[model samples]
Target: MSQMTLEKRFGQSTVFVASTLMENGGVPESATPESLLKEAIHVISCGYEDKTDWGNEIGWIYGSVTEDILTGFKMHARGWRSIYCMPKRPAFKGSAPINLSDRLNQVLRWALGSVEILLSRHCPIWYGYSGRLKWLERFAYINTTIYPITAIPLLAYCTLPAVCLLTGKFIIPQISNIASIWFISLFLSIFATGILEMRWSGVGIDEWWRNEQFWVIGGVSAHLFAVFQGLLKVLAGIDTNFTVTSKASDEDGDFTELYMFKWTTLLIPPTTLLIINLVGVVAGISYAINSGYQSWGPLFGKLFFAFWVIIHLYPFLKGLMGRQNRTPTIVVVWAVLLASIFSLLWVRVDPFTTKVTGPDVTQCGINC
Candidate 1:
């Protein structure tokens, strides 16, 4: 088939992407339809050979710092604190689509690399993708699902006053600080991730912004939703979902150091989200107290400081009173996910001096 026709076929839908990845044998054991689609776009890209590896670029050291060197160094100094955060993608274990099962490794490597550019830190292949496009993809991921979900918790915050007014549950009354803390956390995540993405992609914000938010929203939300699903499974003691790229969904049943590495890799998402939120909580509470009890933002303060009180303490007790099972881990992971999202808000890079990272922005013989 012509390259143009092949591209069209691959772009058909999530199912098509799934089928292609599965057919290529690159399908991850835990990959989701959304991740599969993304992999297809990159691997079979009819254009964009000009992409560069993002990790090699630095903010602006006059060709001094690489994207990976600068951002990773800074974030590492930050202890990669975002690693402690939560609501990461659960492990997906669905069946791989039939037919295409040949190009599995290439597709798996590509998908895995994409995850690294956006989330993974240990993967050396991540920096291979062009700085420009890699970051554009990451930002698209951030502004879409990660940020909006942070806003959902705001609904809880917005309703706090109403909850107090309506239920009279508090002799002291309270507002919801949950949302604000979450919002701040999400903001931080955005800032950190964005900075890195920019340095990696090497494309100016002007060029990135030229792309619409809707597509960003669609790509990002779809990606995270899948991840969020996988995260839920992690807490359930299930196998990690490798659904994003399907090189060969064949369960080798062969556990190796890589499995440990895969697991160790997970530390990045959870750890990043956890620490950032904790910091935000400290920051929020201090900020709230400084403003006095008069500020409704304190409600978020309380929620952040004492979600055990706000959610588990109250709800767990209520569940006990009603003889219900209150799975706190669910709530815990969700909270961490919220914090994970919060980190997205802070995503940013120092700017890379390299020309292109790779597939998305590689300059190897392609246009610079």
Candidate 2:
């Protein structure tokens, strides 16, 4: 019964509404329980339209997993406006996922939904151009759907420092004096924005920092997975299962659930990322120690970026560790296995050494 309610709420609401609307030519003026049952029976036999037109034109848009966002986008495209309101008293409250695993799963569902909309035909980037969607409004919608794509660049940004440290090649180009000023200005501006928001909104610095941490954690893990999942569904007709996040149980009052780990494929990317960054930090420090003070400057730059990634993932790392022996053995094995492979690959590649000519090439008359 709960499953039926969930399907009706999130997945099948469009179908239900469409069935009634199309059958009655609009909402009926009056109805009885008997008539309702008959209508239900009729709908059960006759399916609803799957396309954007017809039934979906009225209720929640049905093509994507995120019907709420799609519905709002469609409404806005037709010139409907929305206003933000803050009441003096609390208007609504609900249970939220408190555990690390549940929280990550919740984030994964949202990211997956956003990815679905992004790849769908109703994507705000290309769709709604013919409608009355204002430029700013359209841009906002575009940002909502497009944000999952940022995981790609975020992952790269997180990985590049480690790669540079391992290879002994600081390939990142140095900017000019003018560019340096611009870079510093941009960094300061971000700090200023955070400061102003905290000051005006009465939000704590710790809360602000936690938000930043979760952004990186979710980006590298859930959002990254969502992108690939979305691509697979779109290109190969493969579908991802929609797993609802588990709600906090009564025992969660002590927050013991917060440390509990659950095995999920979503854990793989972030775990691998964490291991690589840690390895990078160790390898970088070792390299700097062996090379002496002359190498310290470049090492500082590399370490700064690598440490930044590590700091953002600290909370996630803590969750993985859990309390005492409660941590899952599977997670430990996978993380260690991946870390070992990465370390071995870095050693075998030995990018710091110059290539030596083979004896066969040296013996050849012509240059090989």
Candidate 3:
């Protein structure tokens, strides 16, 4: 089905470069008119000469990392249908980043680019040309364009629990109840579905789990950083350069911790989050002990949240502790700054004074 869609929509025959076809004997000289030759040259050099031209029918375009998806969105907005082809064996294979820092930088650039496209006049959702696009096509492009926006909420969720713990507050309900059960079930269902989707896409369980960890770490840190840079470009009229990821290979297959000074800033957010979570867990446990474990319910929630943060922080922690070179000096500075800020908040800001109460917990039995 996908092959047929690819053939019907984006078959190579539909895109004709007169010079190439003539040189390769794909199209005969007799068939190539002089006017068509001119148009072909124009299309090759600059994109779509006219919106109504044959070149406009081309559904997808591949260029630089940042421009590729933007081009696809533009074409789709112009009512051309396209599909991504992920073959078992790639049609083209290239070097991939072997280290987390490089990978995060690559995603940051993509996020910034996608955000730019989303906010542009050519945004798929609000563009005049978008009227011709089908609802699903428009939705797909919308999803692609706004994907980086998730970083905002994701960052909040990742840090909120630690903040609450520091302030001696519980955001989650205390007693196990119907609503909590429902929430737990929903979370499990979503997680299971994600695992299934990854498995179906030929990802191993370990790889999928590692990818999720990266998602949390990178999504909150690098993605949010990209959003900030992207906003400066879009709203402040600043120009940002596109970043290319390093494709350096590791000599051994095992993970190696190397100090990439350029990306040390990217480590700040995750490192700060790790420190906060560690502090929160230790403080929460001490507080619980002092309270005769009466605060076990809230303590449990804090511990669970800390556990989740630790899972995502595992790689970063490993890198930090591995060797002197593995831990960047800038990261330590950032961590210390964050710790001081958190300490001030804990002492003077008084987050606990204006405590936000949780949902009313209803007692429930095992069957209920």
- The global C-alpha lDDT for each of the candidates, from Candidate 1 onward, is 0.38, 0.78, 0.71
Judged by lDDT relative to the true structure, which candidate is superior, 1 or 2? Answer: 2
lDDT of 3 by residue, 229-271 (tens): 8789778988777656767555644444244434547888888
Give the per-residue lDDT digits (tens) of candidate 1, residues 164-273: 32221221334479876887899899888877888886768766553332222222233334344334443454433344433234564332212221212222222333
Worst 10 residues of 2 by lDDT: 46-55
RMSD of each: 23.9, 9.0, 9.6
RMSD score of candidate 2 (Å): 9.0
**Which one wins on TM-score?**
2
Give per-residue CA lDDT, model 2, range 1-368, as digits (tens). Answer: 36454345323443345443453344444655677776667545435434324344545676777779999999899766677756779678777888777787788788888989988888898998889999999899899999999999998898777787777777457789999899899999999999999998878999999999999999988899889999999999999887778787665675666666677767777788888888888888998899888999988888888889899999888877657875577777787798778767876887767998666855875775
As a whole number from 0 to 100, the lDDT of residue 59 in candidate 3 is 35
User: Alpha-carbon error at 301 in model 3, in Å?
Assistant: 1.7
C-alpha RMSD (angstroms) for model 3: 9.6
Clashes (N, CA, C under 3 Å) per candidate: 130, 0, 0
Please give the ranking of all candidate structures by TM-score, highest first, separated by commas.
2, 3, 1
